[model samples]
Target chain A: MTIIPFPARSPRRYGDLVVTQPMALEDEADDVRSLAERLVAGEEAALEAVYDRWSPLVHTYALRALADPHDAEDVTQQVFVAAWRSRHTLTPSPSALPAWLIGIARHKVADVRAARARDADRLAAVVSLPGAHELHQSADEDVAEQLVVRQAVDEMPDPRRTILFLAFWEEHSHAEIAERVGLPLGTVKSHLRRGLITLHRQLEGVRHESR
Target chain B: MSHAEPDQLAGLALDPDDASEAVREHAQTCPECAALVAAFTGTRRRAGADALVAPPAHVRDRVLADVRAPAPPTAPPPVVVRERRGVPAWLAAVAAALALVAGIGLGRIGTGETPAPEASDPTPVETDDGGEVVAATALTALDSDAERGEASVTDRDDVITLRVRARDLGDEDGFHEVWLINVDGKRMVGVGILADGDDGEFKVPRHLIDDGYRIVDISVEPDDGDPTHSGVSLARGELA
Candidate 1:
């Protein structure tokens, strides 16, 4: 099992960390912008691609907020439905996509909770289950950022994803991961590096977008 | 081509000391690689802490099913979700500017005569929505309704000058250049640079506007000398 502790990025000491290489950033940014444009143009494939990529993260948020599987499922469905209709308004940015979807999911979850409040006093149950702030922090921006990064890690393609799980979740070294996954030492290092780039790119984009 | 590959950069992210001297030196000087390493390093330790719980597979089917059927009237109407979840001030500025531009476009139609194009009148054009208009417009900052400049097409004695003026642009460490982007968003033609903030005049094949190159744009291009649009718009407006 991975360490449950949350770790923050160490402070940057040198170089212009804010100014990204435009060439590569634009390449990744273009893919995001084009997907957004296509979705706006009502291309159905874009919708499916968006769903497949982000549904797990959306579902996780719904589940955590509502704590009831049925309500979570409904909210997940409503968020995507709302996304399709309001697709025109989505900002054409990469990190904005997931963050946008999460915003919708938040709305749908609130609606479910509101409906529950109307029916009865579920306050006692909510208060007793974990800490009150934990439940309340479901809507917190920090939590959303965590889920966004977690989703990025989870969604990475295999070998990279598998390698990272071993590296981070299991605290395995490069050789350990290679031995366990039955790959050469060099191949494991390659996947590790690739995974690092993907995760960092996503993290930076989301942070920039959020800020 | 001198820049490092994404993979090499990623390797340097974890610990710069572990890297070879050449790679470390390269990353220290390259802002792009530095920015990338900065991005990669954050959230790395905490990212894998939480395992994802996959939702039931049927959820996808249900979402697709809802897409097929229109929402029932009882359901709350979907709100256009523009809550600015992750959009920065710069992008939001563009959104607001676009809205004001839309308002201005409508106003032009109301005050002008029949926008129909005369066969010889420099090819007046119509929008996709079928309203016609001349080829002059105020270029507004993409962030606000403030008019940063003006652009117009003038044909004097058969010389076509796409005269454009803009001011107070972003200081993006690049020279400013002008372009005529098509309404279709696919085609574009580069005009000359703004060249000292004066009302710069440029010439293009007059037929290009007739071919739907009606949007005037000013963009900041890096000294990279790429001669490409860079997809970086400083100020823009459709030819009204």
Candidate 2:
């Protein structure tokens, strides 16, 4: 529930671009570095700290990837256990722990999918089902898309970021967001519109970069 | 609604109920507008799907129990250090020359292989007199919570080769730069950028080692166009 903040000073402008400093994300980075250090030092409590911070994302990703609650729960446990085992080999940086956990999640998800695929192939041979492959493919794509969107939102600047989270994560209406955040309804609408546009552009850029 | 402005399109994408009838009509007919709306809606839908779910308490209990359990005996026995005094002068010179070549080759090859296994099983370099002269130690995390590493310093001929394998030093915005700080803490020598792995081998300048620069420090350097250390040390270990 850390509130990410944009730098308070004047927004620095380049040619035609204005760059807002990411103070909140930077603070989160500092926190991550500290947590990673503790985990590396063989402190058992640090393991819990990491789990508390990242288990939600890990679980959500696994749920989307595996498309089963039980599988997601299993993957979540596996990811944390693997992370603990390999704590000694982790890089001491803020992004390192999250990145490492995500990496492990990706691998675990892949393994689950592979296992499911083998099962599906065997079942399909005995009793053919149409659109099975298409369904699986779309589900995988959905998980990847969700991951990208989550990352973009995580990096977004203040009001827009908070507004988007309120609207989507908290399922708040514009009026509710205004009331909760103490902003004018008009301002909330404007911010939501602008935030959506920014998120769309960021997602597009990610797609291109990955390609 | 002639052509939806970026914000208008974003609004339409976010919620059709909030949009004007005219905007909704235009989106239905205009493929471009429709695509934009679809993309926005899809992104919003997926982002919303990541609602936080607290993992079951039993899972936590299980993880804690597993982690708390004593680690299995998998690692090899620790290397024992032995000192030998009667080394022939010619053998020392030959070893130094071979080390110099190996160090240069490592640089040319670049870092790609895994460093973890090699660190645990350090290859013994034989001198002309069949004596081993490798000095190594476990590098402890400095400011980080869990970063740990190992460093091995060997004298081949007169070339001082330093090999390091560090783990859990998470990714950073800037690069991880390795340095050999003098024991006196006044002077430091820049080794090189630590690659995206746990291992790196550098040919240390003889003068640096001779001058007592034995502390290995890894600092995160911001990409702010600064070449100097940002004074943010992530991990540190002294070469024995």
CA deviation > 4 Å runs, candidate 2:
A1-30, A33-44, A64-69, A87-100, A113-138, A144-162, A169-182, A189-211, B1-42, B70-240
Q: Pick the candidate with the highest TM-score.
A: 1
Q: Tens digits of per-residue lDDT for model 2 on B60-138?
A: 8887787666443342111111112243554344323322322321212112121222342233232344223455546
Chain B TM-score of every predicted model: 0.47, 0.44
Q: What tens-digit string does per-residue lDDT give for candidate 1 at B71-150?
A: 45433222221111233455444533443444334323212232333322234322333323346776766655666677
lDDT of 2 by residue, A122-200 (tens): 6555337677656765675566557656765765788778888999788898899999889898889889888777767
What are the candidates' C-alpha RMSDs?
17.1, 17.1
The best candidate by lDDT is 1
**Predicted structure with the largest DockQ when compared to the true one:** 2
How displaced is residue A4 in candidate 2, in Å? 43
What TM-score against the true fold does each predicted structure earn?
0.46, 0.40
